[model samples]
Target: MRAGGNIEITDLMRFGHLAAAVFAGWILIAPSIDCARRGLQRETPLSEWEHMDTFTTQQGCESYRATVIEAEKADSKNLYNARYAYSLCVRDDDPRIKGE
Candidate 1:
């Protein structure tokens, strides 16, 4: 204790160390806590049935769409056909569309 019963240098140092430890613990666990909270809040997966496919050209996307259609036609009960029936191609270079 200081002459006036105030906190001494050692006490300050101890408090600083404790604060540092708490801060470090929070940093380590913050992400996990946030992820857990998000998991609880999420009722379903972000994209349960939809997926984005990137292709170098429009023809590639068309080809994939055709393939998906054929696969659907081959088996109406196929899950892929039901999920991707209205598949459309967007040009990567098109300014109106966003690219990933």
Candidate 2:
């Protein structure tokens, strides 16, 4: 990206690589849920958790997700907020989130 919204060639190349890699790897699905309404805060690609980088492998995604869960468990935060009990890892190409 540059001034006047011009996309640089380098940016296109990077996006091309990422687009290809998206089909070959895993993505961590870290969704925060509103328990009372049983509503999901990650029902779209624009969700805040989408900012997390994609993992190149399921093992990597699982390892990171587990660490997050452990941290959440250890932290005695207020329960009035959100919960990540439904957080998980899914293939990047999964139909549910891949917009297929």
Q: Could you give candidate 1's per-residue lDDT for residues 24-84 as a string of tens digits?
A: 3100000011244432212233222133566655666777777877867878765445445
- The local distance difference test score of model 1 is 0.47
Candidate 2, 80: how far from true, in Å? Answer: 11
lDDT to native, each model: 0.47, 0.64
Candidate 2 per-residue lDDT, tens place, 1-100, comes to: 5667898898889999897876687776655555786666756452344425488888998888777667677655634123344566777667766555
Instruction: Return the TM-score for each candidate structure.
Output: 0.38, 0.51
TM-score of 1: 0.38
Separately for all candidates shown, the number of backbone clashes (residues 3 or more apart, or on different chains) is: 0, 0
Give the winner by TM-score.
2
lDDT of 2 at 83: 39
